[model samples]
Target: MLQRPTMPGYAAPQDLIRRVRRTWFLFFVVAIVIIAAALAGAEFYGRRSAIEALESQGRTDANLKVALLTAVLERPRALPLLLSEDQQVLDALSSANSQAIEILNRKLERLVTGTQAAVLYVVRPDGIAVSASNWREPLSFVGNDYNFRDYFRRAMEQGTAEQFALGSVSKRPGLFISRRVGSAVAPLGVVVVKMEFDRLETDWQSASRPVYVTDNHGVVLITSIPSWRFMTSGAIPQQDLASIRSSLQFGDAPLAPLPIKNPAILNPGASIVSAVLPGSGEAKYLRLLAAVPTTPWQLEYLVPIETPVASAVQTARLTALAFLLPVLAIAAFLLRRRQVSVMRIATEQAMREELERRVVERTEDLSRARDRLQAEISDHRDTEAKLQVVQQELVQANRLAILGQVAAGVAHEINQPVATIRAYADNARVFLERKQTDPVEENLGAIAALTERIGTITEELKAFARKGRVAPEPVDLRGVIEGAIVLLRSRFSGQLNALDAQLPPPGLFVMGNRIRLEQILINLLQNALEALGDRSDARVEITVTETSDEAAIAISDNGPGIPPAILDSLFTPFHTSKEQGLGLGLVISKDIVADYGGRIEVSSSDRGTCFTVYLLKAKT
Candidate 1:
């Protein structure tokens, strides 16, 4: 082999080989550094996004708890105010006559039968209870002396007061609502209604979510966990504790602070804190608080953060590694190819003229290699973009779809119990509202009214069915219009103000079943009402005009006119444009009119629609 001509300071191929080794080592180190940085950034971003979602969900739960508590507290407030105004309660308080006291006791029992109140009692001016709803029980509140109770003393001076305390006789805790009878100047006695929250607490506990309510002074008044009840939310001064103890409001139990500490505030009314809930070890919780309405109380709700945050951090790190590994691999492969190219150039340079010609070819090869490398890089970048899109899709699916499926199953299993509890809440409120009126007489009258309504519905159903058809009679046209409107008003209550009815002159009659003729008009009128749903300037007009042989009653509405496509089949059975209904009204109406030797005519446009019933006139 011919050797290259040597010149002064000429480089050897051995030196270039050593340089390629050094470059490869450097590339390896750089790739490691890039991977470490990517992991760190992913972790931080993932944790921040997860925490924001956690706080938002915690706030919603807090609001629901506050609303339920407000409903429970406001129900019994009516009891004391009503009793304070009763003449029998006033007479009983003024004089301690045994017969009047007995009468008042029985009356209180009747009043509290359907209410959620734990007890309803009347207190004398000296703070002695003379009548109680539980007067017949062994632990009756008939003779309990409430002179030491803050609710009784405050009502004596302030006309009305509210206090949450433990009952001395029942040894149970409840909210006591008291209102003074008569006036502050000449006070007769006090009316007291104690409302318990056992059912409310039970419902909350069943949800397995930690929640608690605190008074203005930060003392726990209601809680899902029994161990947390009567506990202070934070530090209480010695003086305040002493005053609370002297009032005997909570009895002799120790009021220690709740088992939560070291809160790091995340936002207003939200925090991350270490809490020890019952039946679980200590964990970090995102706590949210909301103020209960109509009361000086705040509710705190807690949600654990470990499981969700950890999942987010794990998903983020895996995605980062997945994106970086392919890029690093491509870099390594390109570096290896660069080393091979350098060695090829060195070998060619030993042959002088061949080296010159190969140099140009090598330049073109390098350009082509660069273009191929760029293409490879672009392909990898596109893959990385698709990977990111897939990761986001997976994250969204895992968070919403899977969680929603589980939630739906849980909701289905617990629907009945939750509905029953809500029904109880609704019924209690309704009972209290009615009790404010003349409850005894009004309740009996309501039962009678309901019975009469049932009978009326039965009679109407029988008439609509047309069972045992009656012979045709002289049906007055005016009476038919009135009856049809009365029947239609029930379905479209509060919407009849748009109706403009024009009745026929007296003595104008038709030979048809009275109810059947009414049915024909009812169907037309009901369709007009349904068509004019919620449209502005809605109107329905009824005109009764007579020809020489037939009586025509036309019903029309200023609604979107019936479509031409369906108008041809308007009276066909089971054909309708409405979203609801059996589509039998117009068909039945057609049959009824046909049986009476009558026919229907329809005219429609974009502005309005009209259906006129033509009936044979009777010789009246």
Candidate 2:
């Protein structure tokens, strides 16, 4: 051991060891305190920021839902009002002529199809449904009495009325929009449009957040969760429930409080709540509400907060440690360097070298800590990115679900054409075996025509399934209608006398795909024929008319007419009355007409039914 002397202000080795130990201990204590304080502050601030972000997200979702609901609900408001002012509606209401009523029914049906309304009808002054858009469906509202409905009574008394309730016939929830027709003093009943939110609710269900719309009484009328529909946000008074029950507003639903726990009001229209989801256990959420414009309803949005909060806390801890470790290491190095300088002045070089070695070790430890913190931050970012990608996939999956719904009807439609083609081919083979070339030629021609029709139908199906649009051209209105009738001739051979067709001049044209236009006409004719099943005097009349800018094709039939029960969803996909009906005929027809800047409508009563297709005339 070489003699080592202490410099000024430097103690002996044992004393210096004690001082260094105390200094290290004090540094740790202070560093821990500082880090703890910094972590505490950071966690507090981060939690606040996360909560704010959650609230912001909830608010944005609430507003967006409100806007969507408002747009969908408001669209049909003008429809009822406009139709109420129509001269034809007033004439139909005043005259009570079966023909005029049928015509008005067709007009209303067209309006419903064009506007995508659940049902459009004109109530007589006596509160009887006179003409309805679903006149051709088994659930036609025509001839059904609606005298007891609040919307009808209110529209009769207040000039206009709006009511959200379960339809008495359809047994589904919807908003009834009604406007008084004719003069206020001599009002000729009410014009009504029912709007269903099933599609809207389906769209909402695809979102990550929980969302719903509640009426004035806090009863949830629309919700992404089907089970939550008709649930109450808060306790409902017995009297209110009784009244709602008596009115048949919600149709025998158990109006229980929503499944939420530990609700704490944070501010107006905002709350922090805990809820147990279907698959997920209890979780905290930031709940927000926004009022729907022009409606006494509020949209609620809920966002999960636990994930963000936990992430914030972890981030804060890692950041505090990251900064604190480096500072402690630097402080320790400086202290060791000072000790080395003092020792170098009086002691051997070995003592200074030992102190320098400790400094390097401390620096390396801090560097390692820093690297770990950086790795954690990178992992956090990667997790967040993955979460975003998962959200996008969820959204895309929802869209695919919609496409699947549309495609469900495809099998039914294609099956019919395929069956018809097979039947025609069999008939042609039989005729050819008998050497009846004329009949064989006729059957083959029919098969060829059907094959072409199938091609057009498949093309339309492909376009719809792909969410693509088809180009419109000048289509011969008469030719398309005749082609449709020709397709139906074999099926209606026994009732040929019952088919009445009146066509416009040969040159009449409309802006649409010819085959799609034929498809629309064929659907109407087939539906009419089916409705006229087994009736000896079953009749179907086709009339075409032209205007300066539009061409109209009216198909009227004397069938039993549509029933009121299924009228509300007459054009909805997969809704049908026939055992084999796919319920997509009217839906596809509506879509085709809409794509071509045209519309299809229907009116029905006990006397008969009529469907009208309106298309824009081709420019010369």
Go through the candidates in order and give each one's C-alpha lDDT. 0.78, 0.81
TM values, all candidates: 0.54, 0.50
lDDT of 2 by residue, 475-589 (tens): 8887998777766665666776788888888889899988778778878888888888878888899898877788989999999888877766788877899997878889988
Model 1, span 117-159: residue lDDT tens: 8899999998889999999999999888999999999999999
Candidate 1 — worst ten consecutive residues by lDDT sum?
1-10
Over 4 Å off, model 1:
1-22, 346-620
